[model samples]
Target: MLSVMSTRDEEIYRSCAGELTRYATGLVGPFDAPDVVTDAFLKASGSSRWDQVDNHRAYLYRTVLTVAMDHHRSSRARRAREQRAAVPAVAHQPEIDYEILDVVERLSVKQRAAVMLTYWSDLPADEVGRLMGVSEGTVKRHLDRARKRLKEWLS
Candidate 1:
């Protein structure tokens, strides 16, 4: 369906896809993340969904989460098999801002989504409000609260 979309629709969907990919990548490994994101897009663009969306990006995100969770569940056996197959022991690399992602994780899903969609995805507040099914003022409050938490955590 996306393959046959008009230019404007394609552009909007592309933006959605790009963010979905990033979100999926965070949820899974980079090696398989693209496939996960694309699979979510495929599910999202299927016939049943094309006519029933208020915010397509948020719909795509929910799709990504569902797909990624399924992937993690089904792939666990394979992951364990590969883990025992003479694989190099990967050490945990330190993140400079693990504190921030940690603090962000402490937020409720809606609050975290609100912050990430606005600050990380670079969408406007009103647009994020639409995506997260909240008013603009509500989105602003969530973002402000998330930011304050992050600032206090990282300071």
Candidate 2:
């Protein structure tokens, strides 16, 4: 069903678009951020609950994060599929590093996001929290827990 966005919704979108795009960029990357933001807005605007959401900005942030994660998962799956297909044709290849991959796979999505935004993007905890729609302290907790898990898993 097609949902018609109210004028207020349009206004909210206009106000939040830049920040949302930046947040998406942090979650995904600059190359895919615009597409991710557009996809997120489409998903959010179509939701039945869009009209009733108390915090539209936060809702949009979460939706963008979700879409970005889905994009990441799909990309990973596609690459894995290609690698598997190539395995039969190329018998001589470097062995897969399953241990490191397994360790990364063990991390929760939030932990991975926290680590990526923190270390990969070089974003501070407060900025990560803003993008993640969480408190700065929550971001700190996620980072601390992620560090501990990585340390334990690697050691």
Candidate 3:
């Protein structure tokens, strides 16, 4: 029963957490992923309407996108000063799913968000459109453009 199954509110946090973090990392940078994801989660947790939310996952996702975009702006301004010199790279996480995540990496923010919510998260176009606050046609356009780009790279 959806009732006893840990409120949809918390499920929202768990379900979209990985995809949101991945999208944020791809949009901004991996180093800021955890920070942005944590900020977004904080925002969602603080919202007054969290209890009234019928689709909390979508709400949290939208919040993540907004926070990530903000982080993108803030970091761009601070980038010159913050650029590291001769930082040693570490090995990749062995448990990471490289394929879909790779494809996600290559997409633009809008394209990636659209594709992630639609395909990876299995949300409908209309719901994705609502989450992004764009028209359904815009959602389709994002999907189409993302698909074209993916095909070009994968073919």
Candidate 4:
């Protein structure tokens, strides 16, 4: 069934699309960012309370975070399954800055989200907390822990 979005909702989506894509890209990566944004907008449009949202941007951010986290979890599970089936071999790996990606990937989902929202998206801790449905203090804690781990790992 086709669901129609109000003009206000359309406007909100248009205004927020680029920022949300950038935010989602930070969380998920470039390959999946567009899909994640699309999914978030679709969910927002489908919501019965779409017209009632006091903060459409915040609502959209939260939706994108949820969708990206779901994508991350599913991708991790798929990779785990693939790794289990892979044949063992001593192959030389190419040198690259994979350590950064590895460190980010090792973070708990909440910590990763907090770090991305804070540093990559340049969002304030309070806003990141609102987007992640946590308190500002919690967001700070996540960022603190993530920074310490990243520093230690990169050292």
Q: Which candidate is the best by TM-score?
A: 4
Q: What is the lDDT of residue 49 in candidate 2?
A: 96
> For all the candidates, what are their Cα RMSDs to the real structure?
6.4, 8.3, 6.5, 6.3
**Who wins the lDDT comparison?**
4
Candidate 3 colliding pairs: none
- Residues 103-127 of candidate 3: C-alpha lDDT, one tens digit per residue: 6666677776787677666889898
Off by over 4 Å in 4: 77-100
Superposed on all Cα atoms, model 4 deviates from the true structure by an RMSD in Å of 6.3
Prediction 3 TM-score vs. true: 0.64
Ten-residue stretch with the least lDDT total in model 2: 87-96
Model 1 bad stretches (over 4 Å)? 1-16, 24-39, 51-100
Look at candidate 1 and tell me the lDDT of residue 111. Answer: 62
Error of 2 at 50 (Å): 0.8
**Model 2 alpha-carbon drift over 4 Å, by segment:** 1-4, 77-138, 145-155
The count of backbone overlaps in candidate 4 is 0
- Candidate 2's residue-wise lDDT over 1-155, tens digit each? 55467788789999989877766654555545677889999898888898788888878877888888898777777656756675453333345555655666656667766776777668898977876878999999988887788897757
Query: Local error of candidate 1 at 154, Å?
Result: 4.6
TM-score for each prediction? 0.52, 0.57, 0.64, 0.76
Better of 2 and 4 by TM-score: 4
TM-score of model 2 relative to the true fold?
0.57
Give the lDDT of residue 149 in candidate 2. 83
Tens digits of lDDT, candidate 1, 45-143: 774756668767777776776777688668777767865784543744333355444554556555656766776778898887766667999999987
